[model samples]
Target: MSTRQEEATWTTLETFDVEVSSPSNRLYRNGRQQVEVTVKLRARNEDGRIVPLSEEQKRSVRLIDYNSGEVLPDIPASGTVATGWGTTSVRNEYEFFPGARDGMPGQIGPAEGYTFVVRYVQTVDAAPKRIGAQVRRDAQTVFKTNADNVQKSIEAVPERLPSFDERATSVEHGWESQRVVGDENDWDLRTVDYYFCGLSINGNRVKLREFTVRPASMFQWESTNPASEIFSFTGFGTPGSSMAQYNVPAAFSDRRHNPISMPSDGRGIVVLIRSNGIAQSSAGNVHKGACDVDARDEFGTDHPLRVSFKSSSNRNELVLTRR
Candidate 1:
């Protein structure tokens, strides 16, 4: 016996309505974040009353690029099926990211706009046959610069420093006579400083607000210089909450003012550091330590600076080298 196949007919679903909603219309040009677009379909009969979508109708739903009229195969989507039989509407969500193609990073697209559409095909059953219908709605999203657009970094004037020995003098006595011998460098204490520089939109300087310093386990903030006429140190001797607050200079021309206006040459701000007073055993012995600098700009963007340094454990020995 031979079987015959007949062609199925499709009809226009005029009564059905689709609504598209996008939570955010903006995306970061750097492709660091994504925007969620949701589409909802409301099925209605000729009488204008809401009705549930059939399984075949839900299965035919797809998200497409409106400009190209092609299905979006890469954007992740969900909710093609209704939650329950009595549900009058079905919805789908698409996660759209900048520079993403087929769910992977491709060439960064132009910083412009894009349009996407949610399409649904409804299938209707007729006597001995079935009919297909389609409906669609579109959503638009645009790209913008990343929120933290100002480039942030730190340049240590001298990447390496010499730690001096604090105990350079020794005492010896012979019942009747005594002599003292040791190297007198007179410079047992030192400070390491760093400068900050970066540009904002249109080559503008970043206005620094504050500085937070977090020392490593082998190091601690120097407690000797607790306060200065230009700035005050808080949480000194405590690595966790160490911070420096600047006193608004009485005049911008004051040479002792804290560098708050970052310069293109990185000569604006100076982050000061001193040893925590951990002794070393032998001469030429080197100890390494580091601290993290968190700087807040005028835009309230936090820039991180990782600083590394070296020191000597021998007493009264100057290990820091100047540039």
Candidate 2:
């Protein structure tokens, strides 16, 4: 007779614990700046002992947007897992750009406020397991432009008719003006230039489209050569024409060439008003006029700007107010 001993076999169940670090509270609207988010994961058995994961299992870490409920394909994690008693952990670092319009690394746009989370999914023993940790509750972003305090200037040039030089002794034989012009009394051409600066949307440079300018009762428009009469430094087509149609180059939007008095380098829109026979502080001449602008952003959103101009004997002032 042989004595047989029965041995008991059991399996230890493995579980995963996830921990995440908070991200930046504020993100730039331009998407040039990024916030780093970290996620730490650990695997443990039923007996509280650390369990190491394979390379394939570690690649399952992902970053998710809680608001959109989608995995952020642009924000990929980078790090390694350490296996030890107290140091047993899988660390992942992700670069989060809140305003990234495109999923690419440097592409940016106006990103709204969103919540972020770290997620891990895997299948073990014919069962699926999903784990996630919150990285940030709420991250705020901003995108806007300031139209207040717009600077303006008025230039007056005298209009003269060409006349034959009767006094010419065959020395200067040609048509010449009667006299050198001066003061507003001799002014026939008036030019009003309105400088619009700070044209960025959420810290990102945007192209202006569908730009239309309308002048009130005081200002008069000429039917002839409307393109030359009403035009912008941004290169707009005929009045009310869309800038998108011409595909205006980005160089036109660069504010570096604008007047130094401008508030910022974000300047883009420059509207010039040209008129004839408009006198300053004259009895019949209108002193008050309103200029209305309708501009569309890259997102096809419309932003209106209202401006009023008043002229006096001493000076001329233009006030820009948001609508």
Candidate 3:
């Protein structure tokens, strides 16, 4: 007969916040964001101590743009070693902020203006193998007894009898990504980022780039997921009129208002659920935001298309381009 053992179950306790601040702020951005989490043990040894073993375990975290599903590289696991920290607050701080370090590998600054959802996963060992034994066409499959002087005979079509057993073995670990959302909460840092984009301002436009860990379907809409579009026009007025262009939906909800920031050259607009918020935060330093007063503009409101603008403005037109 063959026997099998039960698999180990690793439980995730909790995660840290996705901190967002500028380089000017005390906050600093490293090449890779660090995340500290708490994990609990499932079983212990004979002496009641936690069993520990080292193996090639895969630990990964993903940071997804809540509006556009774009992944950021704030906490990519490629260059850093995945190590486990003992129960302590010092080891529980994960960094999602973008910054520069002397020997770092990633860019610095916020991934544009949009926020994202995070997911973390780890792969642990599983149950043991199952074994079985079978006896087919046996005179006595269940309990064999010395046959009487005469050999016993039966016409019944003998069935294959089977038995099972289990054996315990070594354990290993791995990880996966899972979305974390609640009825009320702006921050959900469950996943880690793979890369980050630096901030750049060209003329009157600003662009930011980042890496995402999930697809578009996950974090592009819904209330609490606010969307913003910021643009600026330089000095001097347009002879007749000017316009703004984007790679997003054309129409904005009535609740949305375009609020120009200081210098009056910049215009900030907020879009509601009417538009998918996915790509809104991925605008990199090179993002192109030029106002084309002559070209016919098409906002992606009609369908799933890029956003373009041609709004009439008295101030000098500006372009915000990102790659």
Candidate 4:
């Protein structure tokens, strides 16, 4: 909140007049900010000397909600303090918050002007008899400006599983798991981003990109355990050299995982890949992957697909082969 002193209004009564002012005239449309309205009670004796309300007068003073037309009490404030000459006063405070009328994040339109008012009155009444006086009042026009108001802050990072385990001594070199119908909910991919973490096969880190974190669907449930696919990478930085690895979140043998797919956009998601508020890392490596796991188009066959050379036909066609 940019706490700037704003102009307020004043209402004078017989003995004491209420001084009203706000800490700000501009606020955010999010309605999270509260404008502090300070109310100070001032008194003047017949000798033209400023004085304080008596103990009885202090207790007698009341507060009213001018906006809702209702009387209020015990409004939080800087409790009464002695100024000088035994003349002291209490400073009462109130807040006026503004918000979006549409109630949605992008629904609310451009900047809008608004007016919120609050008033107070001192009153003492007895059965069938009443005496009321104004203590303090505020009727100021405040604006709900565009949201360049509040300070920017980073909340927290999204939770995700780590890419490596410290206890594991060696990589398991084996082809163990079978391809079976997997649970539609098991999207084992890098959902959160790893900044500057050298998880890339090329010794460089890549951003995972943020997306919508959605819950896996139960309707597509097929099995508790899903099958995993194995992929091998070959021919990079070596003369006629090659390497292969299966794309599995667990050990190379822990292949009981269902394949899941999620849209790059936020609309519909399949029982595959967890879009944990971010685009997950590609199946094999962040950049490189087995060509067999993902299909390709002529020249646009992502650079990773080039590593495997699964199909050399420069045609934008789909072929199905059942082994």
lDDT ranking from best candidate downward? 2, 1, 4, 3
Score every model by TM-score: 0.27, 0.28, 0.17, 0.23
Instruction: Output the better candidate (1/2) by lDDT.
Output: 2
Tens digit of per-residue lDDT, candidate 1, span 147-264 = 2211211101101111111121221111111111112332233323323323243343434454444532122222323331221111111111233233222231122223322222
Q: Considering every candidate listed, which one attains the maximal TM-score?
A: 2
Whole-model Cα lDDT of every candidate shown, in order = 0.27, 0.29, 0.21, 0.22
- The parts of candidate 1 lying over 4 Å away from their true place are 1-11, 15-20, 30-32, 44-50, 75-277, 280-323
Count of residue pairs whose backbone atoms collide, per candidate: 11, 1, 74, 13
State in Å the error of residue 58, model 1: 3.4
Could you list the CA RMSD of all candidates, in the order they appear? 23.3, 25.2, 26.1, 23.9
Model 2: worst 10 consecutive residues (lDDT sum): 152-161
What is the alpha-carbon lDDT of model 3 when measured against the actual structure?
Answer: 0.21
**Candidate 3 wrong stretches, greater than 4 Å:** 1-36, 56-323
Tens digits of lDDT, candidate 4, 148-186: 212312111111111111222332211111112334343
3 or 4, which is superior by lDDT?
A: 4
